[model samples]
Target: MDQFTINLLFVGASFAIYIGIAIWARAGSTSEFYAAGRGVHPVTNGMATAADWMSAASFLSMAGLIAFVGYDNSAYLMGWTGGYVLLALLLAPYLRKFGKFTVSEFIGDRFYSPTARLVAVICLIICSVTYVIGQMTGVGVAFGRFLEVDNTTGLLIGAVIVFAYAVFGGMKGVTYTQVAQYIVLILAYTIPAIFISLQLTGNPIPGLGLFGTDLASGEPLLQKLDQIVTELGFNQYTAHDGDTLNLVLFTLSLMIGTAGLPHVIMRFFTVPRVADARWSAGWALVFIALLYLTAPAVGAMARLNITQQFWPNGTDAQAVSLEQIETDPAYDWMATWQQTGMLGWEDLNGDGLIQYYNDASPDMQERAAAEGWEGNELNNFNRDILVLANPEIANLPSWVIGLIAAGGLAAALSTAAGLLLAISSAVSHDLMKGQLTPNISEKGELLSARIAMAVAIAVATWLGLNPPGFAAQTVALAFGLAASSIFPVLMMGIFTKVNNKGAVAGMLAGLLLTLLYIFLHKGWFFIPGTNSFTDAEPLLFGIKSTSFGAVGALVNFAVAFAVSKTTTPIPARIEDLVESVRIPRGAGAAAADH
Candidate 1:
């Protein structure tokens, strides 16, 4: 069968499974809609959390960024994976023991203030909405490429599918569907890496193959890659060349953001017990690590593969002739991806050859002058395209390519569903039922949840049509918001005797400051021409807006403490609630209290 048909088959089959699971696990009540009726097994919840946490950015764009930036990008790997440790250790069990349907509920009740819950709902909405835009964009890109549709149409199709599962099944449906998604995404990701690893390093494990000797060159795989890329005027793959402070801050931001994200936190509430929440986090990491550990290997190996393909003989040889690219089946992936305007080349010197290398290097400039080359020909290789194109680049079977298409869609849709659920629950449960309409019926609450989800999807799709940045970068902004606003308040609510006034003040400070910083640098509301400063000229202490979340979080902590010192103490009942959540004992009773 042709590639298009195979892609449809795989992607279609995966969607069918998700829809079926949603039907089977359709939520019957507000409890099922919001918390999966609190009956999910630990292992099952863990897999679901992995699928929910690892969005399109993790599956589609992260390795690609690592591939282009090398060791300097290792922070993404460490920050994202390490955040789960913080979650498992500090947040998950305690939150689970609190037995709330939403994170905002916990914050509101803990602080004994509807205003605090409302602030949390706003933060959750901002963070979830920002994060969902990235996922919607990913869905658009994946659907556009594989289904041969325009991005807007592809986005609509994806939105429809997500609406079907998310609205019908709620958290119950999303959880079971995410388990299926995790299976598809992991298999699609690893199978290609395994094949590429075996071909390049005589090892089946991509992680080991990344460090193992290259079979042809008899040198460490990374050493060979560093030598080849440097020969082509690119930086060494093993060197760290980015600003050290920004790197540290960015990593810390992602870690804290991961722990604080409402969507991931909500997953813990679905499991049966506080102990289950803890174990579920560990299992989630195990599933997440399967891809996380292999990602660097995929990035390094794919970079090497692309470099080798460009220079068939060696970097010293003449560039690949343009005629070869036009006529050779090996170069077909470029032509295919060029349709998306993401990968392209031009014969800049009219030499009828393609030179793919770093054009910004001074040494490369001198060599180009000596060789009568005008400029680099590969002018627009988008980082997001790397993983989706990996199987095609390696000439893998048509089925593997199809599987990858399915996997990318799964990754995008699962996270979109998860984020939408968080947004909906915050609006319906926390904002409306908890505060505005306390007498609302359970059926009315479920209806409101569905309506909130539909609105959130529409908003996300609209923003995705004109995304401010790539999938991962936009997601990073969401993380920054969460890191600054939600995570700190939760920690204080659980660990400290922070009063309602203090919690309210801290959330507003963190949320406003972080959003202000992001808007100034990333464009006002992420519109293209509204920004006063670029990331290269960050206004705050050489700290890029992307890395400012950690600082914002610190400001939240300090200000909350200072504000609390001047305020009244926590009420006796709220203190008892805090003490109750700190221990796993009587979690069953606590869960039943609401």
Candidate 2:
């Protein structure tokens, strides 16, 4: 089959599977819609959580970041996964034991204040919406490239599909669909890496091949990559040159953000018991590691492939000819990806050839002057396409190309559906029924939940059509919000005797300060032309937006402690509540009582 036909078939078949699961496991009650009735098996919940956590940011953008930036980008790898360690140890089990449907519910009950819950709900809405926009954008990109449509059309189609499953099926439906998504995505990611690894290093395991010696060069894969990249004016593949304090803080932010995210936290609540929640987290990590371990390999290998393609005779030689580029099947991935308008090239010097070397290279400067070259001309190569295009670059079979298209869509759609579910439940269950209309019937609540989901999908779709930023950029905001606001409040509720007044004050301080700093850099609500500092030279001690989340989180912890020490302590009964969450035994049947 042709690559397009194969992609269509695989992507269509996967969508069919997801819709089928939604139909088979349709939700019936508010509990089912919000928490899958708290009956999901640990293994199944683990798979579902993995699908929810590994959104387009992890699947599509991560490798690309690593590919272009070299080893300094390893912060993303360690930050995202290491956060789950905090989740598994300090947060997941206790939150599961709290037995609540939403993060706001816990905040409301723990502080005995409706105002606290309302603030948390606002924070959750902001974080989830920001996060979902990135997924929607990812869905559009994945669909546009494989389906041969414009990004707007692709986004509309994906939004309709998300609305169909999420509005009709709720969490029960989303859970089973995610399990299938996890399978398709993991297979899609690994198959290409394994093939590329074998081709480059004669190793079948991509993860192991990353550290193995290159068969062609008789040098370690990373060592070879380091040499070439440094030779081209890029940093070494294993070198770390960014600010060390910021790197550590940034990693910690992502970790705390992962633990605090409501969508991920709610997955733990769906499992049957506290121990199940713990094991489910471990299983989630294992599933996530399947992609995480392969990502660095894909990034490093793709960098090598693209570099070697440009400098066929090494960096000292002339650029590759346009005739060679057009005729070479190895370059076919470029043509395929260009249909989406995301990857482009131009021969700036009119030499009928494209030069892709770093123009800033001191050696390249003299060579370019001698060779009558202007500057690097292969511009606008979107980082998000690297992982998706890897199979094609390797000249893999058409089926693998199709599988990757399906996998990218699966990764994007699965997380989009999960985030929509969180948004809907927060609106209907936490905001509407819990506070606005307490007397509403279960059936009425279910109806409102589905309606809320539809509205959320529509908003996400519109944002996707004109995405404010890339997936990684948008998700960074979401993490910053969660790390600053939700994480600290939840930690204090479990570990300390912070009163309602203290918790409320801490959350507001954290949320406002983080939002202000982010807005100062990213523009108010991410709109253009309203920023005070460029992202390249941000304020707050020169901390970049990506590094601000950890600082915001620390601000949260500090404020919460200072406020709690001066105010009235937690009541005796609230201390008992804290102790109750710490224990694991008899936590299989959690009570809603505070």
Candidate 3:
């Protein structure tokens, strides 16, 4: 079958399964809609959490970043996995023991202030919205290529499909649907990795193949990649040429951001008991580690494969000819991807060949002069396309290519569903029902939750069109915001006796400052062209905007403690509440009301 037809069959079948599950398990009550009726099995919840946690960023974008940015981007793997440990061990059991339906609800009750709840709702929405944009970006890319449509049209179609499932199913629907998605995505990701790894290194395991010697050069795969990239006038693939301080801050931001994410936190609320929440966290880590271990191998192998495609004989030989690109089956992936407008090249010197080396490299200037080349011919090769395009670039089977189409969509849609659920819950449950309309019935709340999800989808689609960076980088920014505004307060609420005023002030101080710094660099609300500065030359202390989340978290801590010292102490009853959450001696069933 043709590639497009094959892709349609796989993606359509997966969507059918997800939508069918949503229909079968459609939520009916507030408890069901908000926390899956608090009866999800620990193992099932863990798989679902893994699917939710490993969003478009983890599945489609992180490997792309690692492929291009090299050793520096290893921070993504470390920070994200470490952050899960913090959430599981440090936060999940306690939050479940506290027995709140949402993170905002927990913050509101723990701090004993409606205002604190309101602030938390706002924080959750901001973080969730920002996160959904990355998912949208990934959806656009996957659909744009597979559906043979432009990015915008693909994005619009994806938004509608996601909204239908999310609004119909709510938390109960999403939890189970995510489990199926996890199976599809994991199989899709690793099957191709095993194929590519065996081809490149004679090893079936992608992770082991990453460190194994290249079949052609008989050198370590990383060493081969390092030599290949450097000769192409790019930085050595194994080199760490980034700012140490910024790398530290960026990783710290992702770590905390992963913990602060409302959707991931909401998974713990769905379990039957506090121990279940802990077991769920542990199992989620195991599921997540599967993808994490394979990502570096995918990145390195993909980089090496692509570089060799450009220079089939070697980097010392002539680049791919226009005729081969036009007619060869091996080069067919290029024409298909170029339609997305994210990949392209030009024969700047009209030599009938596309030379893709880094023309700006000082070491390449002499080569350019000798060859009489004008400049580098490759243009607008977006980093986000690396992972999605890898199977095709390696000339894998049509079925493998089709499976990747399904996998990429699942990766993006699963996380987007979770994030939208978080946003809808915060709006309808935490903000509207709890504060604005305290007397609203459960039916009214449910209707509003679906409506809120629809609105969020619209907003995310619009912003995704003008995304400020690649999928993973854009996601890191969202993490920064969450780390700054949400993580510290959640930590303090669990570990300390910080007061309501302190929580509110700390949240605002961290959120506003981080948002402002991000806007100055990324753009005003990520509109694309309104930015006054670039990340390369940051405005202060040589820190990139993506790295500012760690600083923002510190500011939140400092501001919270300072404000608390000058404010009233926690009430006696609240103190006892804190003790109960910490000690984790609780009833079997979680109380329904927050």
- Say which candidate scores most in TM-score: 1
Candidate 2 residues lying further than 4 Å off, grouped into runs, are 591-594
Candidate 3 local lDDT, 1-594, one digit each (tens): 788899999999999999899999899998899889898999999999999989888888889889988899999989999998889878998999988788998899889999999998998998998888899989998899899988899899899889988999999999999999999999999999999999999999999999999999999999989998999899988888999999999999999989999999999989988889888998999999999999999999998998898898899989999999999988887887787788898888999988888888988988988997888888768878887888988778989988988999999999999999999999998888898899999899999999999999899999888777778878888899899998999999999999999999999999999999999998897877899998999999999999999999999999999999999999999998889898666735446544
For model 1, residues 1-594, the per-residue Cα lDDT tens digits are 899999999999999999999999999999899999999999999899999999999999999999999998998999899899889988999999998799999998999998999999999999999999999999998999999998899999999999999999999999999999999999999999999999999899999999999998899999999999998899999998889999999999999999999999999998888889989999999999999999999999989989888887889898888898888898899899999888888998898889988889998888999998888898989999899999989889999999999999999999999999999999999888988899999999999999999999999999999898989999999999999999999999999998999999998998899999999998999988899988999997889999999998998898899999999999899889999899899888877887
Query: If scored against the real structure, what TM-score would every candidate get?
Result: 0.99, 0.98, 0.98
Backbone clashes in candidate 3 total 0
Task: Show pairs that collide, candidate 2.
Answer: 83-255
Model 2, CA-based lDDT: 0.87
List model 2 lDDT by residue over 377-462, tens digit each. Answer: 87888898888888888899999989998999889989998899889999998889889999889999999999899889888887
lDDT of residue 391 for candidate 2: 89
Q: List the residue pairs that clash in candidate 3.
A: none
In model 2, state the lDDT of residue 582: 91
For model 3, the superposed segments whose C-alpha errors exceed 4 Å read: 587-589, 592-594
**Residue 379 CA displacement from its true place in model 2, Å:** 1.1
Please list the Cα RMSD from the true structure of every candidate, rounded to 1 decimal place.
0.8, 1.4, 1.2
